[model samples]
Target: MTDHATTFRRLHQEGLLLLANAWDAGSARLIESVGAKAIATTSAGLAWSNGYADGDTLPVERLYAAVESIARAIRVPLTVDAESGYSDDPAAVGATIARLGALGAVGINLEDGDGTPEALCAKLDAIKRACAQAGVDLFVNVRTDIYLRGLAPEGERVGATLARARLYRDAGADGLFVPGITQRTDIADVVAGTSLPVNVLAYPGLPAAAELAQLGVRRLSAGSGLSQTLFARAAELARGFFRDGDSAPLSAGAMPYPEINALFAQR
Candidate 1:
């Protein structure tokens, strides 16, 4: 925790902390080889990869297994997306997060979803206490879905998010993640309105990283886009192979087996 937490926190304050979210150990290692500063797991990606639908339905044990595998394979600080803390009980959620800390995770994304701000703050407080008890400085990234869930009217979205951001921060959050925000003005408003580091999702056609940084974004996440794209390609290849018996798509833009296999080898 000492080695990773300090670095992960420093990254958010310095420059853009771009995370190529991984669903498995293989993806974590691959992203690390390409020089990702940290590893973040996409709950949606993890669910899809594990044959479950994206939602708050992922079992904590399965999530732990995925994180454990990735933790063992990568040296970079890892942040797991623990959607809604996976439980309504704040203590249960905190215990689960503490388990992640033991597995070498430096941070977690605990979303509020459509839940109340008070409830999410309770979870944040509990998680902070659990981390302290465990002697781990886990970066609790509180994700507010006011925009994503349409919890407020268009005119009131920014204010709603800001209000929740302050509550989460007061409850012990280290960062704020607002996924549905794309507009530069709205982004700047959120940044100026909050003391926590702001993280935004990389939606299609959104501004580039340079533009986002100028808007005061401290982190950018690819969410489940990478997994969706990768799996989409696999489905396309399978469809083509069965329909036309053409294997050409198999070799197109695919990394060589040996190169990929080398990623797991001892360095």
Candidate 2:
């Protein structure tokens, strides 16, 4: 395995890998400056930044450009959120992952939204093959939306997730990301059900980091929460500026231009 891949995989076995998702190169470099272990891209955040909605609506080339930009802007390992692989065909998804690997992405988030387990398994198999061909030890974190999309009842959610986790692991997934799961009991059950590293999305009701580690979660991602919060704050700032014609609100908590420019100068 490459050093980047090794570092990323080892993180899952050690402490909690906290990922603050970035939507653009500037956001990525800023996050990396804060001592993040790795950089993750949120599909929704990227899409919104590019004036496109999520759900695979962003052009494939645009996604590639964004990933490449972020990869070039940071020193740490990058993990692209390639939602649903951006294609239904297994080979196509594999090719996309291989290209991402070539662009310095050591990991990817592939989801099984409404697809069948078998189809996701097939896609995973193809991804493994592509990674092998490229000699990239890409960490594929398979995401199941049983709870996020309301695919199963509250009582059946854990069971449904476990079944998909087994299939995905068999298909060579390195980790299992169960988003929208915050309860301690449910998190513990999913962690115990799988040997693969468990990744959870950070939400309002989610337990603290210490508590999550105790429950055996290896990674916690902010998903699109950071971007959503940022834009919302930006909107408020704009509203205040327009109403009162004051620069005070816009200047608060803003990074100095010199420091912001230094991030790119060091590159």
Report lDDT per candidate: 0.91, 0.93
Reference-based TM-score of each model: 0.98, 0.97
- Candidate 2: the clashing residue pairs are none
Per-residue alpha-carbon lDDT of model 1 for 75-144, expressed as tens digits? 9999999999889999999999999999889999999988899999999888989988988779888899
lDDT of 2: 0.93
**Model 1: lDDT to the true structure:** 0.91
Q: After superposition, how far is residue 59 of candidate 1 from its true place, in Å?
A: 1.4
Q: Go through the candidates in order and give the C-alpha RMSD of each one to the true structure.
A: 1.0, 1.1
Error of 2 at 41 (Å): 0.7
For model 2, residues 92-202, the per-residue Cα lDDT tens digits are 999999999988899999999998989999999999998889887899999999989989999999999999999999999999999999889999999999999999998
- Worst window of 10 by summed lDDT in candidate 2: 1-10
- Provide backbone clash counts, one per model: 0, 0
Over 4 Å off, model 2: none
Q: How far out, in Å, is residue 92 in model 1?
A: 0.4
Minimal lDDT window, size 10, model 1: 51-60
Residue 246 of model 2, lDDT score: 96
